[model samples]
Target: MTGQKPVTIVAIGTLDTKLVEYLYLRSQILEADPSINVILIDAGRAAIQHEAITVSQPEVLKASSASDGSLESLPRGEVVATMIDGAKRVIGDLVNEGKVHGVIALGGSGGTSIAAATMRELPLTLPKLIVSTVASGDTSSYVAESDITMMYSVVDIAGLNDVLRAVITNAAVAIAGMARGYAVRCATPTGSEVRKKCVAVTMFGVTTPAVTVARQRLEEMGFEVYVFHATGAGGRSMERLLREGRLDGVLDLTTTELADELVGGVMSANEERLTIAAKTGVPQIVSVGALDMVNFGPKDTVPEKFRDRKFFEHNPSVTLMRTTSNECRELGKRIASRLRANCVDASAIEVWLPLKGISAIAVQGQAFYDNEADGALFDAIKAGLDGSGIAVKEVDADINDPKWAESIARRLVELVNSKSKG
Candidate 1:
């Protein structure tokens, strides 16, 4: 501990409204480990003058090209937005410069929004924790694809009481410990480490067998496989990693999130789901695994318009609606268009269509089986990539067939090798 670098923890909040609370939080952090360095960032609208405030409100406004006058003249939403932008820039610079090991913030909705926005920009390796009044409900918007930890504040962050103190003290201690570990990890050398070539694979409950066999085969071929669940957040996370150049290849076996996006389902990953790998020139083998179903919350939650659609109750809380032939065709066109439009080199991409079935429930007598829909999807993809250099192959077996999964894995290995050679 004597020779180790000091762990620096950043405490961010609106000082104008919550100066006392921030002071207490900082005190608790330093009390836990006096050697830990704490930097308090004031994101308040008003410029608060205090030596303890490492980054002032004025500095934040300047980072976002705003002034103190803008706070009064601008709408509350715009003011918060400007402050968030400023705080993000300030925090981003600190993280880049290795001045921040961990970040923690306490706030209501407004404070949480500012802090969450700033913290989300930082690296996932850095510890980010937020104690917020709205943490008990759905926090997908706040934590989206980031590893930011959210803690529920039992009471509002108005003023510190016994409950608030206990919560703040616990949060402080947790962050301090995390910061110490993070600092140690940062100091550790990693340049000499030998890591296997990593591949990102997408999966769904309906396509688990295919992904499982493929993942195993990939591992056997000496590639490290990261399997993402194909949920909205999971797909987004995988795409982010791909853009960051963390993945060497992709085996996109479960493109279900695309179905969710196309059908206005709850788990949509947006329109950018399949474009990152193409833009990055990462060799990818795409398939229509689980494209047969659009995810919904429950049987009752299925929209009134889709009441007549084929439905599979995955569980009491999870429902799957079969994609119509028209929807399948559109999804195919979207996937092919994204790949073709974004790919720097079409040779790096391959589309594999399973002829017999795409998902577990789509084979033979299962609930979602529909040859017409699957055919529409395949035809659209082929048509969309008609002149493109990308290769489109059809496998006679169902997606989960062991040999088919193995072939996909082996082809990805070839693609990766071919890219390296090129």
Candidate 2:
């Protein structure tokens, strides 16, 4: 271990409720590896016995100036939000400054929320672990796009029981091993040096043909193409990369996530789906690929009102619902409006429409074919851009047509090249 670097792990929690548990976790981490150093940060909202605190409450509170006076004086929601901001700043600074090697946290829902917020601020490859009572259930909100490992805490974190001791000890050992073995840092700093230009593309099962061709063309043009799966989480990942300056341009071919968001569906993305591309001014080519249907879980999960509407069983676990003309109109207006507002710094923005069809299932004889809905979408987008400077183009071929995909690929390459020259 002579050449090995020192390993430091950050233990985060609301120390007021779980002080004894955290202390045990810290001890176990040191016991696991003699070389591991531990820092106990107090993220508790309520006033606690400060004698046992490592990173004092006042220091943590200073990270976020947005918070009001006393932590207890504000409402519960405000407290959680403020602490999240503060924790993110503290943890992010530690990683950037190269003071912390890994992060581990133990909490229930509220505590997990605080720790998760901070962990997300770190990069994708960092070793971040969370032992939570809510880990066994839906953890989408907790571990959005980060590489945080969630270990189910069979017993509550209120106190130390025989069951909790083993769980906490195992989590401590896991983080210790990870910290000792692997060191994570930002491999490619944005704009640090010249490298391959990255293009972000969106794809779905039905629109795979378009994205496949586009990806090949972009790669052949000496660019790196990253295809995102158009699921709610996938869109969020793309947005994060855009914010981080990891992408050079965007080929937004599949806007199906918007339909899911507008309707109540399992794959729905948040309202901020397209805002990042707009605000970042990344040269983006938009399309209505796969916008013909909204995604839902099983057939039984489809809502009561939508039961009468057209439904296609994509698979045993997935159901697809066709969008009505009225719904398509709303989606078109929303996409155009967002682009109009956020594309100020963009060098160019174009909306491509596939007149023949938007997806495999939306063709002439396909189950999801609905010309009225598709037309409404197309017209609404054009109407929304009436005064806006963004250009709209229509192609005679279907969305999956080889020619259609090639055109989109060429358009993105042209925009990227033009931006570089300018």
Candidate 3:
């Protein structure tokens, strides 16, 4: 498909409320490319409020009803949840059935929520656009872990006036251009025998040496490594690809997000970060890379609850706190449970515990140093994995040491190659 090729440009909105805006978009798309295919999808629950536009029902029907009653009568939260689920199901069906090439929507709060849910179900590469009034606020909820683009509707989605008309027209043209441009570049990949196997790696600033070294080694060994920053979204996206079955393997170096899980830090990947490789059954290499400290924001951003914890400043923007022995115990327990659950024969998966120190700053007399704290973490892992069959090779080197990095890279290569042979 190319810009010159006929493409599906979805014209979606409450044809009931903004049939004018929807029609205007259809005109803009036609003006851009007369050979384009425009799809009118009715996602609205109620009958369109305007004169009957003879709109047809969607191929995938999504019923958005809340007891067929007034807002006061229905539970608002339940209504939104129901609509979100229906929209996602319908959109998934459309994409799976090869119906929609590109998607465009103009909506308010309800539209933003519903339309975003639908777009979120589509893959990251697809062309998605939303001309929304609520694009101004915390769109994190609607855009969570997806690549849906949003444009602010300066004027409301009510009856279109001069300002409304300009915004809507520009949005439509932008979406049309996206569709055409994407279509133009839609040729199938060639058999160049150069399929770059993508591997996802997690890293934080504290664990720079290990991540930097491992990335270089992996690339040298003919693998493309994607380094995720271990922030809330970064870890979430790493797990998302793991579930989507996109990774050849995973090197979960900086488990700092696990810190956020143990402590109440801002960049919490929670329990999900530790188990992605296990769930996906990928060639996974786990490490206690940056578990020495939990992540937080500015000094004051440290929750009042954790104000008494020992803190170190990575920079003015980043604050780090050493984990307590008790916290380390829980973290080890959590990690062990994941390893045990993902236990496999042939010993492909392993966790390397750098006994000297886990992070650059955790070595003797460094900012995060506390042998007692380190001892607690080590003991917890030993006790938790008493007989789980998960290998725990304790090295006498600090985590950033050359030997530790080499071991990790060497073992991962062996595991991946073993799987390749099998």
Candidate 4:
């Protein structure tokens, strides 16, 4: 089930246009490891004749359940969508049938889009790489919430040339190494090697003190604590793990990403930050740990409307803009809605508020201290959950105070134990 299985690397591209380049890539992979098995998936829709076709366009269309003529007759968007669907189905079957160990795809904009979509359907631990002509730009679309690795094809992925050969050769070797390594390291553990009870905690620079203390205490109580930075990607990763059943409980302390998501900041985690734990019915302790500020990159990056607002220069490259009372209220209401939808078992959820301050710069005499904003957030949450039966507690201590951190750790332990009993 592990390395005992031979590594099979699936190479996907438009063999119609790049048959010579595809052959060169295959040669490089064989040069790296002669035993490595390679499968060619032709995802092109054009009716170009090519002799080196392994998995033909007709096969892709059949797997995707699209009419053979749709690729040529349909609009370009529809054509690409159908091809992507076909690629996903084919890749899924290959993995389930033990024919695919890793996936490597190379192409331009259209090819990259199709390849990335296919790679995203694979498991998180699978070795998925995309060598693309558009890798250096905004890759959020290509790697939305997946573990697909992308490499910039310095030169275009055109026909074989001296420069193209070097890029494709390097990519081939990299994928080969990735496939071999994944096969060995990704086996499920057993016996005493099994993991301890896991807990997910959120962290940001402003809330590090509290999170660090809570994490240490949780580990002391025989639990494995994973602290995800409150960046967009970090929150997404945490949610992904929760959905995968990797954690037993959650300590969603640093919810500052909500502010960014609501107010158009750079580090927003969308609206799904606290939804997964609630949906899974996992025991959770939520807090407004760092909701006082929205994250932005550089002082100049702040929008014109926010330029006059209270701003803290977090570092040379980062700026923290204080959220307004209206924004806090909106955030609180949004959070409550998520909790109501997902946390159906009210007894399993607890919302804690730090009365003194929410983050490092929000305490009295600090840069982000805004009593009106803080009060609005607190009142909004209380009103939103007036009859929801979820417990809301207020602490007079600052969020980073050792006493507050200790209390949070203890409460989470209690909730985890109670859920385990149920």
Candidate 5:
């Protein structure tokens, strides 16, 4: 039941058992927004004894299967993996074919898993709603870095009832309202202006001075700069954006995440952090922005093994630990090796070293002063890059100095333009 077919409201669930529930939802959504188009997607293999749109599961499977028809031929465990992959492909094809605008799915644990998997594959702008028993517990896993709204079914969806129907209707109508009233037009319009190149910068409070200086310098050079705090989430999101091809170049100054990664700290980035620059092969300028600190929770919560380490009270709740010489050596080698992986892009990268201190406190007269430790870090950077031809410079100024920041930005602009032209 549709009027203008402005949006395709997707009703997805286990059509074998929850067909009635999903069909009711489709009817309710259409009733709420007459202009909306309701498209039923049955991901389940078995059919239910009810009204439904019967696109064969085999057709959906074909859309996601590999060459030689091997994707559908996997074992049950592998099938579950492939089904999630298959659902994502089916939903994506539906979206591309202009058949679905908003998606609504209801399921128990297994169904919830598939629904969430599909919803996640859909972009952030698309409205997604899931009604599941899984929503009652920790939803972090189900909604990992996604925007799908989930509602817990108070009763199991054994069959549609007065209560269950009411819940489904609410979700359907809410989705309809979200879809019809405030339709999310994709940000990337058909004729919108082209995206400008954006610069990615990494910083912590310790490296704010440098980042601020660098941002201003890069902005003057006609580049958009996005600074990410050197925290776990910050690093992850930046890498995610880089992989999405959203970043033009990187000014990764505060490389403290690598220290935490190797030393076992709270703010440690995953192994993928340092390797991103090499993987993307994009023009990037990197330095030991905040290699001095290993982050932890509140001061009192620091682990027992590193109780004697130099601690800095960055703020009331946050604590920072200076990396040891050995830790610094390992971290430097790890970073150099990662950067060295992209030999083709090596000329596009430069590992600048600040001679004074890596961070504010590590300088000659600061509380965390340790010239030997700083030297160890510098030595690691030198030894790690056994000549991939990646430029490694040793600047005499402190990292926070304005000169240090400007130089990094200038070098990045040079590499970006070089790569852009070639």
Candidate 6:
């Protein structure tokens, strides 16, 4: 304990409005662990002077490069944006310096937004907790893809009541404990002397077998595999990790999210999907798995225009619509264009086509079976990559066939090996 670095916990809030609450929270944190260094950051719009405030609102604004005048003069939206930017900068610096072990915040919508934005900028392993009045509602905007823990405040975060006090105390004590444990973990060295190569694999329910086979093979080859579902959020998360340079190789076997993006499916991962690996030049083995259908929430949720389109009720909540030949062609072109325009090294990328079927339901006699559509997709991809150096291979088997899956996995291993050797 004598030579140990003090565990640091950052508490962010709108001090001008919740000064009493923040002070009480700080007291509780320090009381829980006196050795924990707690830094209170004021992210309020108005300037406030308080001895307990470690970082003032002006300092936050200055960090965001918005220190032209008092925060009170800025519009509410602009102020919140500036505060988020400033807090991220401040907290990011602390993290870079290894001073932040944990982060905790309590607030209403504005406070939650600022604190959550800042906390999201920190590492996923670092502990982040937020007590919010709106935690019970849809928190997708607030939490996003980060691992920030959110607890609903039974009452408002205004003047502290018995319930509010209990929540704040619990949050403070929890963060302190987490910070101490995080500090200890950071100090401890991992048992493995050599870090294993990590691969990011994309999957969907339709392509589970393929991903499962590939994942097992990668692990057997002493590689760590992160399998991300092809849902919108999952795809976005995988792309974020790829951009952060957290993965060595990619097995993009389930590209159904692109069909969702090309069509009007709810599971679209947006335009940025599939571009990161190409731009970053990570060894990738891509396939046309699960591109035969677009996803919808329910049978009724399918648009009236698509009423005549082929449909499969995956479940009571999910409906899958078969993609038309035109959509498939467009989707293929998009994928090829993205890779061709962004790929830094063509040798590191390979596209595999499962000629028999791209998804579980696209085989012969299946609900989504459509030879014309599949042919359109395959042809478009080949045409788009005509002059590109990227390799394109075709296999006469379903995407989920064990043998085909194993072959794709082996090819990925070969690519990674070649990259390492080069």
**Model number with the top TM-score:** 1
User: Candidate 6 overall Cα lDDT vs. reference?
Assistant: 0.90
Which segments of candidate 4 are over 4 A away from where they belong? 1-3, 47-54, 65-69, 187-189
lDDT, candidate 5, at 155: 88
Please give the CA lDDT of all the candidate structures: 0.91, 0.87, 0.75, 0.87, 0.79, 0.90
Instruction: Give me the displacement of residue 151 in model 3, in angstroms.
Output: 3.0
In model 3, what lDDT does residue 175 have?
81
Which candidate leads the pack in lDDT?
1
As for TM-score, the candidate ahead, 1 or 3, is 1
Clashes counted in candidate 4 amount to 0
Q: Model 5, stretches more than 4 Å misplaced?
A: 1-5, 9-32, 43-82, 96-112, 120-194, 298-304, 313-318, 360-369
User: Better model by TM-score, 1 or 5?
Assistant: 1
What is the alpha-carbon lDDT of model 1 when measured against the actual structure?
0.91
Which of candidates 2 and 4 is the stronger one according to TM-score?
4
Per-model TM-score on C-alpha atoms: 0.97, 0.88, 0.86, 0.93, 0.77, 0.95
lDDT of 5 at 394: 94
RMSD of 5: 4.7
Give lDDT tens digits, candidate 3, residues 1-422.
44344677765555656677788777777887787788766555454433323233332233433333322344656655555555566566667776566888899988777778878778876889999999888787888777788999988898878887788788878887887777655644565777777777788776778888888888998888889988877888888888788887878877777778777887786556666677656788787777888888889888888878899998999999999888888888777776776555426667778888888899998988988888887787777777766677788888888767767876887877777787
Candidate 5 structure, TM-score to reference: 0.77
**Candidate 5 lDDT over residue span 205-282, tens digit each:** 878899999999999998999898888767876777777787889998988888878888877768778676667788
Q: How far is candidate 2 from the true structure (C-alpha RMSD, Å)?
A: 3.1
User: What is the Cα-based lDDT of residue 410 in candidate 2?
Assistant: 95
- Give candidate 4's TM-score: 0.93
The 10-residue segment of model 3 with minimum total lDDT is 51-60
lDDT of 2 by residue, 248-327 (tens): 89999998999999987788778888888778778899999899999998899888988899999999999999999999
Error of 4 at 214 (Å): 1.9
